[model samples]
Target: MAGLAGAPADGVAQYRRVVVWRHGQTSWNAAGRFQGQTDIELDEVGRAQAEASARLLAALSPGRVVASDLTRARDTGEALGRLAGLPVTVDLRLRETYAGRWQGLTFAQIDEQFPEEAAGWATGDVTVVPGGGECRLDVAARVCAAVEEHLRGLPENGLLVLATHGGAARVAIASLLGLPHDRWAVMSGLANCNWSMLEEMGPEKATRGLRWRLAAHNAGSLPEPVTVQEG
Candidate 1:
């Protein structure tokens, strides 16, 4: 929303579009478990979701595929990588927020065990360190950094898809788009196998303090051109 919309600039390219994809559902997800930094694999439903969504994303012809090293994220990335004929580059920085003691606990269980922390986390409090785990800001920092590194290899008009967790995707999108930590809660969580897209606005827009523009969020389908009728 912050950058100009039109055809991409010509000549040497330094910017690229990005897709931050959330991994498909695991058994833990259906069970309402925290699963933070847990190496959970995709369940049957998750596999189905990944296969279907991969078909859709593969149409975009993504140039690079990257993912968290965790099992769930890696498997999800593999789905797309297989279709796009790209290898998934794994990075520990892209892992979900390590929720320390909260990992593997159900939402209700977390509330019963860590009442105050659960309350704060539910409100999207960036300062809340879940069970003494990484805070939202910390997650954003590392996630965006990994994304930036991958962007360097992206070609002109190329798309880089990142298969990661819900929390990681949300925080990374907010941080990369220059949204303050307090505004991060405005970004709704991504459903299983859904994705968000960001487009770099080139150096000209960066001079105006607008770097990346969010093209889509929590989307299951590719974006289409908008058509409006003049009244």
Candidate 2:
């Protein structure tokens, strides 16, 4: 992530808040397949997850919805858009790292077939391009670019709901937070339809090197049930 991240600045608050939402699960995800850039639709559970998460996120008053152009992320974004009455803007830059030859392969299959390559990426090499797929740093670079561009257009106090893949979300966040490549995987993957919240802290907290605060991570839950009291 070269130009996407910057040194800590006592700069103005750029983004009010960012909700990085991972798209719901597909059969590939359930089967532990490397679903990079493959256009897999949501399964039944995935659809439910999207609907549930969308209901919860709508309460946050998201002013914008942006998502990867893939089918899984797009459908998840559509759920949020339908609920929040917003429109989804698709960006190919937000797409998951192209898995290349591993596009439709399962974890076991990759290990058995391409153990060396799988081990390299699994150990956080970040440079190892699985089956000649996009490198982790490359994914970070593009995702950061797309997300930062979207944040710039948001008004003050506006929340941006971003629907994308788990890998893309992890890379983008790690880059924006200025974390080293080796430590990027320390941030766990987001479960299907789960979300992480990043807040742009104002300059009052200048002592902190970075102004980005991870307010929430792996948050997955629907809105609380509405119960009426009879007096």
**What's the count of clashing pairs in each model shown?**
0, 0
Residue-by-residue lDDT tens digits, candidate 2, 13-65: 45588888999989999999989988999999999999998988888888999
Q: Residue 220 lDDT in model 1?
A: 83
| lDDT score for residue 61 of model 1 | 82
The lDDT values for all models are 0.89, 0.85
Task: For each candidate in turn, give its C-alpha RMSD to the true structure in angstroms.
Answer: 3.3, 7.9
TM-score versus the correct structure, for each prediction: 0.91, 0.87
Ten-residue stretch with the least lDDT total in model 1: 1-10
Model 2 alpha-carbon miss at residue 161, Å: 1.0
Candidate 2 overall lDDT versus native: 0.85
Q: Which stretch of 10 consecutive residues in model 2 shows the poorest summed lDDT?
A: 1-10
